[model samples]
Target: MITNEYINRAIDYILNHIDEEITVEDISNYCCFSRYYFSRIFKMETGESIYEFIKRVRMERSAFRLKVEKDRSITDIGSAYGYSSSNYSSAFKKHHNMPPYKFRRSIVHKSMMNPVFRNTQTELLTWQECSEKITVEIFEDCTVIFERYKGSYGDLSVHWGAFLDKYKEYITEQTRILERSYDDPAITLPDKCLCDICIDAPAGCTLENICTIKGGRFAVYHFSGPVEHIYSAYQNLFSVWLPQSKYKIDDSYGFEIYKKTDCGSRHMDIDICIPVK
Candidate 1:
C-alpha cells in the first residue's frame, strides 16, 4: 500500500479521472492541501511532478488502447483525454517517439510473431485445448486496499510477500489475495508495466489506498501452471478465444483472484477475469 495518504489520494484522483481533463489544482484541492505543498510531497514520493506523472500515465493508458482497441479511432481515443487531433499527434510523438497510428501498427506487427502462432510438433497445445479453460461468469464488485508497482511482473512475488508481511496482523483466513494489471505485458515495455497488489479490505481498515473493482460479466480462465507461463495463458485467452467468442472486451480493467500458490513447488492457481460485453 502507498504509505502517504495525500499522495495516494492524489494518485487515486488522477487514475480514476484520467479520461477527463485534470489539473494540479483539482488534485491539490481534492487532497485538501495547498497546490505547492501537495506538489512537493507528490514529487518527493513518486519521483515525478504531479503534472509529469499525470501526463505519463495518460499517455501510457492511451498507448495501450491504441494497440488493443483497433476499431477505435486515434482521434476518439485522444478526445477522451481532452486532446484535439493535431495536439494529440504532437504530444504522442513527443512522448512515444512515434505517432499513434505508427505505434498501433508496430504493436500489431509484433503480435503476429507471438509464440502462439508458431508451429510445433507436440510442443504446443491445440487452440481448442486452450479455449476449453475459459468460462463466463458474473463478478460482484468489491473494494480493496492495494499498493502500486511499476516494473516487470516477475518481481511481483517480492512485492506480494512484503505486502502480506506488513499487514499480517490485519489478515485472516478469509483474506483474498488479488491483483489488477494496467498494461498488457506483450504490448507494453516490461519496465513500464503497472499493476496493483491487493487484498480484500480488512475489517475496520482505515487505509486510504482503496478502490472498487467493477463488477460485470466476464470471461474467466482458470489457470494453473508455472508462474512464467502466465503471460502465455493470457495471450491464448485474448488472441485465440476472444476473437471466436460472441463477446467483445469491455472497458473495465481485468483482475486476477488468487486461489492458491505454492512457492516451493513453483506453481500458481488463479482465476483471470476479463470483463466482456
Candidate 2:
C-alpha cells in the first residue's frame, strides 16, 4: 500500500521549491535514498519518473500563472518556474508549440468554451481502492474553439494527429498577432459512447485551419501516468470511483495535465480534470 507519509513529505519538498532546479538527486537526498532506488519507487507508486513529476508541478504552476498573471512576460514566467532560456523555449515548444508570447495573447483574451455532462449511467463498478491527494478548483467562464468527436477513442489518434498538425500551422501564422492553442479535453471515450472530447481553438482558425472549438466551466483533477495507461485511471474514476463520490459529473471540459514528452521519459505527466457539478 502507498503510505501518506511518503507522498506528503515528497509533496512538501516539491511545493516549496517549485521555482528551483529540481532533480532525482535532490529528491533522493531529501528522502535519504539513492537516486536509483528513489527513481524506481516513485515510478512504481506514481507511474511516473521523478524528473517528469517535477516538470509537471512546474508546468501546472505556469498554467495558473498564465491565467492570472497578465503582467509577466513568457520568458520571465518561464524563468520563474526554473527554466533556462533554451529549456523554456524547448518546454513551451513541446507543450504549446508556438512559444509562450503568442500563446498567451490568445488564451488570456478569449471567451473559452466549456463542455458540460448532463447525465451518467447509474451502474457502479468496483475498483482497487487507492486514493491520491487531489486539489479541486473552479474556473470562471471563458471562450474557446473546439472539434467534436464520437468514436472508438483508442483508434482516434489519426483524427487528433490531423487536428494537431492544423492547430500548429494556425498558431504559427497567428503568433505575430495572437496567442493560439489547441486545447484538448479527452473525455467522452469508448466503453460508453466511444466518444472523443473537443478542442478549444482560436479565431482565423477554421475546420480547414483548426479554428474555434468550444468553451465552458470545469472541475479539474491532477494526476500522473503513462499516456497509454491514462485511460485506465479515467475508467476507474468515472465508472467505478466517481459514481460513489459526492462530486457529481458535469458536462463541461475534461483535460489531461501534461509535463514532458521526450525520449528521456515517456511517462506522461498529466492532470485529468473533468468539469463536474
Candidate 3:
C-alpha cells in the first residue's frame, strides 16, 4: 500500500514544480521507491495515470490564472503553462469546451459565467497547486437530505436540480443550513458513480426529507476551479494522495461545497470530503 508520507511529499513536489516538466521517475525518486512499484501503487490508489494527473493539474492552474490575470492573452497564458502554441487551445476547448478569449471576456462583463464552475471553456485546463489543508471537525451523527442517481456526473444537472427543489422547501422551514456530498463511490470516474446530497440540521430537527449521514473521521480537501476539473482533485486524493494517506476510504458520499459569488470569491470553490476509517 502507498503510505501517507510518500503521497504528501509527492503532492508537495508537484505543487512546487507546476510550471515545469515532471515525470513519474521524478516522483518515484522523491519517494525513494522503484519506478515500477511506485507506478503500481499510484495507479491502484489514484484512478488516473501519473501523466494524466499532471496534465489535468496544469490545465486547472492555467484556467485559474487566465481568469485572475485578465491582461494576458490566451496564447501568453497557454505558453506560461508550457503550451507550445495557441493550438493548445484545442485541448483547452475539449476540457473546458470554450475558448480562453471568450472565457475571459465573459468574466469581464461581470456575468455569472464563472470560469471555475464552467465546464465548457476550451483550453487545456491548468491546476494551481493548492497546498492548503482543509479544516474538518468530527460530529457523531448529522442529518443530511440526499438523493441517489446512477449516471455520469456529466449528466447530473437534471437530477441535482430536482434535489435542490426538494431541499429548498425543507430549508424554508429551517433555521440554519449546511450542505455537502457523499461520494464514497467516487462518481467522477466510471468505475464508481454514486452521488448524494447532504445538509446539516439542528440536533432535534425533524428528519423530514433529511436522511442521517453518520459522521466519523473525515479528511477534507479544499480547491477552487471549474467543476469539470474536480476529477483531478479526486485523482490526486484517491489515486496518488490517498494511497499514501494513512486513512482508508469509508463508504458514504463525496459532496462539493459551492461558493456563491455573492457570499464567496467569484470563483467556484469546492471541497471534496470523504469518510475515512
Candidate 4:
C-alpha cells in the first residue's frame, strides 16, 4: 500500500519546485518507487495524473496571484509559473474560459462593486462573533466514496440529495459528510466549478468514485451561518487569517465537513478544514 507519508513527500517536493521543470522520473525517484508503479499509485491516491495535478496547481496559483498582485504584469505572473506569454494565455483561457487580463479586471471590478468583497477584511476581524471557534487539529487519512457535481454552488443541495439517495446504504453513524470543491468560484467561472460530495468508507473500499483524503495537520474553522455567507468566510480565511498566520497552505485541497444543514432555514454549521504546514 502507498503510505500517506510517501504521498505527502511527493506533494511537498512538487510545491517547492513547481516553477522548475519536473519529470515523472524525478518524483518516482523521490518516492523511491519505479516510474510506472509510482505514477499508478499517485493517480489512485489523488484522483489525477501527476502532470495534470502539476498543471492545475500552477494554473490555480497563477489565478490567485492575478487577483491579489494587481500591480504585477500578466506576463510576469505567467512566466513565474514557467509559462510563456502566448502559451500561458492559451492554457489559462482553456481552463478558466477567459484570458488572464480579463480575469484580473473582473476581480478588481467585482471587489469595487460587491459589498461582500469590499468588507472581507472587516468581517475577518469580527469573525469570532459570527463563527463558532477556530481550532488546529490532526486528522487521519481515510477513504471515501463520492459523487461528482459541476456547475453553480447554489445547485449543490439538489446534487447532495441525489447522492445520498443513491448511496444511502453506505451511511452510518461514523460516516462523515465531506465536500471537496476543486475550483475557487471567485477565480473560476461558477458554471465551471467542480465539487464532490462524499461519505467516509472503510479502508481499501473500492467504489465507482473512491478517493483518499490525505491526513495531517489542519486549521479548522467552525462556521455557523447562512449558506450565502460561507463564501465570505472563505474569503476571510484566505485573504485575512492565512496571510497573518505562521502556517502556510499545504498541497492538499481544503475541504468542508458538514455538521448540520437545514435548507428550509438556509442555515448551516460546517468545519472548513485547511491543510497547513
My TM-score estimates for the predictions, one after another, are 0.83, 0.40, 0.43, 0.65
lDDT of 4 by residue, 1-277 (tens): 1235566567657866877788888999989999899888888866667787678767877887776455669999899888899999999999878999998877544433223233433244444532346678999987888666546776788888888888888888888999977666666555545576889976666665676778899888888887777877776666556655666666567789999989899899999988888
lDDT ranking, high to low? 1, 4, 3, 2
Q: Write the per-residue lDDT of candidate 1 for residues 200-250, one digit (tens) a residue.
A: 986668877787788999999899987766776776666566655677787
User: What is candidate 2's lDDT per residue for 149-198, written digit by digit as tens?
Assistant: 33344444466556556556544433322111112222211321213223
List runs of model 2 lying over 4 Å from the truth. 1-4, 108-111, 115-277
lDDT of 4: 0.74
The most accurate candidate by TM-score is: 1
lDDT tens digits by residue: candidate 3, 1-277:
1224465456547745877888989988989999888777766655556676677667666765565444557788788778866666877776666777765555323322223234443232122232244445454666665554433555565565666676665554453333443221221233333344445555666654455556676667776765565655654554444444556554343455554322233254766666677
- Model 2 clash count equals 37
Two-way lDDT contest, 1 vs 2, winner: 1
Worst 10 residues of 1 by lDDT: 115-124
After superposition, the stretches of candidate 4 with alpha carbons farther than 4 Å from their true spots are 1-58, 65-80, 84-132
Measured over all alpha carbons after superposition, the RMSD of each candidate to the real structure, in angstroms, is 4.0, 21.1, 15.1, 7.6
